[model samples]
Target: MARAHFAYFHPFEIRFSEVDMHGHVFNGRYLDFFDTAVTGFLVARGCDEILSVDGAGNGVDMADAAAPVYFVRRAGVEFLAPVRFRQRVEVAVGIARMGRSSLSFALEVHGEGEDAPRACGEIVWVAVDRATGRSAALPASLRDKLAPALLPQDAAPASGGA
Candidate 1:
């Protein structure tokens, strides 16, 4: 897919702590990068309320019957190249798909100055009834806010091993 398809990009500076003995970023840290970018995308698109905490600040207010909470149903990462410590990178985020109760976010991590991504991945989140924990339709408000970032179904990148 063309990088232009991404409507939001969150940049990050690789820290020494995130690098492994292999002299590159630890493979596991990509998930953190994706998670952070997801939040930024939502906020940038005016859906910050989706991640709002409860009044008590205990958590996502799973008790609120009117609010649906999202949970990570699946996550995958395909590493294409090694990212060294101190390298600057950016995560491009876009909505790959939106289902009745789930959202799939497509992401690409590109090192600064590189023409291609160092990694690509997808994270699937399921919306569930706060009280019942069962899948629930995504709120219309959220769907509306996120519509702008949704990619054409066929435009999403193919998922697989690196």
Candidate 2:
């Protein structure tokens, strides 16, 4: 994917705890990096606070809610290169598709000054009813705020084939 396509990036350092005995970052850790990037992106856009659903499925304040939080429904990743310790990786993420109840994310993990990424992939997340754990429509306000960071038309093929 082209670097210019992504509008959000979160830089992270490779901690010693993240590396395997072979000195390369563990495969599972890439998911952590992407998760962090996604959270950062949403927070930066002020969308995180919208997740205040209560156990009864009503929208409420986080301080008074015990909602079932957002959950990843599916994720896919392709490791392009091995990332080792002592390196800073910049994870760039963009919204590929936003649906009534789901969102698809495209992400690229790049090392400093590198043209190619250490890894690239997509994650699918579904908003769920807190009490039932079933899919729920995403709030219009949240989607509107995230519209500016959606991937360009050519970057990912959106499903609403209209």
lDDT of 2 by residue, 27-135 (tens): 9999899898987787777775554544444566763243334678888778778999989989998888898888888888889867677788888888777777788
TM-score, per-candidate, Cα-based? 0.89, 0.82
* Winner by lDDT: 1
Candidate 1 lDDT over 1-162, as tens digits, reads 568788789999999999999999999999999999998898788775687844333345444557788899999999888999999999999998899999999999988766578899999999989778899999998899998999877664633541
Segments of candidate 1 deviating more than 4 angstroms: 53-64, 156-162
Report RMSD (Å) for each prediction in the order shown: 3.1, 5.8
Output the TM-score of candidate 1.
Answer: 0.89
List residue ranges in candidate 2 displaced over 4 A: 51-60, 63-69, 156-162
The ten-residue window of minimal lDDT in model 2 covers 153-162
